[model samples]
Target: MEFRLIDRIRERTVLARGDVRLGIGDDAALLVPPAGQELAVAIDTLVEGVHFPHGTPPRDIGWKGLAVNLSDLAAMGATPAWALLALTLPRANAACVDGLADGFAQLAQEHAVALVGGDTTRGPFCLSIVVHGFVPPGQALTRAGARAGDAVFVTGTLGGAAGGLRLVQGRLPFDPADEAHRALRARLDRPTPRVRAGLALRGHASACIDVSDGLLADLGHLCAASGVGAQIDPNALPVPSALRGVFGSAAARELALSGGDDYELCFTVPPADVGAMQAALAAVDGKATRIGTIVEGQGVRALGNEPLAAARGGWDHFGL
Candidate 1:
């Protein structure tokens, strides 16, 4: 059967707000802030099982929901300003909901993001967040502007999250006393988004996208959208020091390139601005390493020039 449920929903539910210059279409929903201001927007969702395991920490769930939305705004090179939250719970537990709200409030306070409004409803456990921010006009980094010959770069190390997941599931043999294991486990619980580095790369980056869908998959997104391809050097991926001991070199490399939920920034910059970009990243105590180069093609290639396979076919709403 052929169905257009999504299209129907878009047609019916798309509300036209005065501030929304464009919505429900295009690469992103666009809004025009007051004159001399900028526009920033982000979307994130938390599902029952996919985002959080059963009986997961409520505080962490709250923190992660806000964090992921902020990560999206960060990817657009915007300074987060406001947020709207929506929640659907099968049965509301006052304590659990309060703890979640506390987590959200704390992070919002730290980032100076105001929670202006929200809605609550009854359904399966799910939470959605939309954050807004601002940047200089014509300065937002996007996935559509990358050009061939641009250098690809990623911030911080990778693979820690995947390693952490393994530890949580008891899938990896590890000593409880090992500091490495402890660190990787923490990474899975809390991920730091590269908001500062993304803002710094604004003018320098020809195209940008957060590493939410693994390095290779996200880079492929940049390529497909920009009409370009990339050659990623396997050796160039920065795997966290702690993860190396637990997973070894080959496994670490795979995780770094294919693992999702890193929440880091992967962007392309012009060769000449490399120094400035590096300098800017340094302010945030973040490191940027060039891992590949953009070329005229349609997908991403890994080392030895082989096409990189999608890890779990990227993050999908339904299932992999």
Candidate 2:
């Protein structure tokens, strides 16, 4: 049954790459990195009822399982090349396998990422995915390069995923026929990884990190790594209109500050390079908004906003 499930995945995701000398059929994958390039690899594990809610569809789970890993590679300004998936299921179910494979393949194809090797087992539902990417030497972005005078920016809007989770948990009122509500739900189900924006920022950004654990929390990580601090202007955050409309400005502001799973890129660039960085992202059909500045300190601070308390609180897996 496990072999059959693997066969289904292989059939659903058919991709060809010269670097992938040997793919899914073997016990190990053979890949060759291009010359003058550095390899960037990232892995993420998603467990049922932890990373996602109970009763979530297999397709959405597959997409998110891969999406999260891709976001990690993007944070380093890498171009995705291959993936290996280890999926666990409660039982052998062909329909569930097909749905998961289809969703995973859809995003893999978009990024030209080939599924090289993986494993399957009968256990509590979970997916562990490893992604490999490549970046030019000395061009990869890292969290430790931010300078005290750098400008802090974020790609795309925030809080939609938190809003979607609220709607899913029945904590927020929503109408099935409303497009705004549906959009929020979509944000939670299928997040767009900021690969292009990361690429655009490679030569320009001094530091970069993906907003998986909310902006404030992730920014705190970047600041800590760079030996710097940040001052965020609450009014400058890019809050989605849908979230503000449904949750009101105050609640939406709080959500934008600390909502997790948004999958957007938060980066820091020199003040003089901000214009060039924005133009580069714009050329890639991406948008970046400046919300703060790097400063000399130890952690993140909100500027004259009562929401500093909320900014300090974000998703912590172990409640640490």
Candidate 3:
């Protein structure tokens, strides 16, 4: 059963990449990395309800499982090359496996990333993906390079995913088929990792992070790592129209400030390079909004010199 289930996925997601010497049939697939480039690898696991909602489509789950890990690589200015999918099922549902493989394959094709190899097992319903990418040596972005005078920027509008989850959970009222609902739901389910933006920011951004744990939470991490502080002006926050429409003004602001799962890139660039960075990103149809500035302090704060409390703002895996 396990072998057949693995075959179900292997059939749907096979891709031919020249760098792949061997793929998906043997005990271990082999690969050759591009010469003169450093490898960037990241992995993530999603359970039934922790990373995604219960009853969500298997297709979206498969796409998101890989997308989130790609977002991590994106944060480091990596170009995706290959992936390994480890899918488990409570029961062997071939249809669900097909849907999941198709979804994962769809995004992998977009980035030209091939599925090299992975394992299958009988366990709780979960999906795990390990992705590998390459970046120019000494050019990868990290959280420790942000300087005190750097400008903090984020790609895409904030809080749409959280708003989408609200819509899904019935906390917000909206028609399921409406354009507004679909947009928000798409943000939550099919998040576009800012790979292009990350690639573009390589030469300019001093620090970068993908906003998986909310802006404040993730930025605070960047600041802490760099030993700097940040001041975010609420007026500069970029709230998605869909998120605002579903959440209204006040709630939208709150959501934009601290809602997680958006998968957008939050990065810091030197003040003098901000214009060039924004222009480069804009050329790719990527919206880079400057909301804050790094300062010589301990943590993050909003306007009027108030500390941005960490408690109710971001997603903490095991918090109160």
* Candidate that beats the other on lDDT, 1 or 2, i.e. the better one: 2
Cα lDDT of model 1 by residue, 275-296, tens digit: 8888888877878888999888
TM-score to native of every candidate shown? 0.85, 0.96, 0.96
lDDT of candidate 2 over 224-280, digit per residue (tens): 999998999978999889988888999888888888889999999998998999899
Residue 102's lDDT within candidate 3 is: 92
lDDT of 2 at 247: 83
lDDT order of candidates, best first?
Answer: 2, 3, 1
**What is the lDDT of every predicted structure here?**
0.76, 0.88, 0.88
lDDT of 2: 0.88
Alpha-carbon RMSD to native, per candidate: 7.9, 1.7, 1.5
> How close to the true structure is residue 216 of candidate 1, measured as C-alpha lDDT?
78
Per residue, candidate 3 scores C-alpha lDDT tens digits across 109-173 of 98999999878888899988999999999999999999988999999888888888777777766
Runs of candidate 2 exceeding 4 Å displacement: 305-307, 310-316
Q: In model 3, which regions exceed 4 Å deviation?
A: 311-316
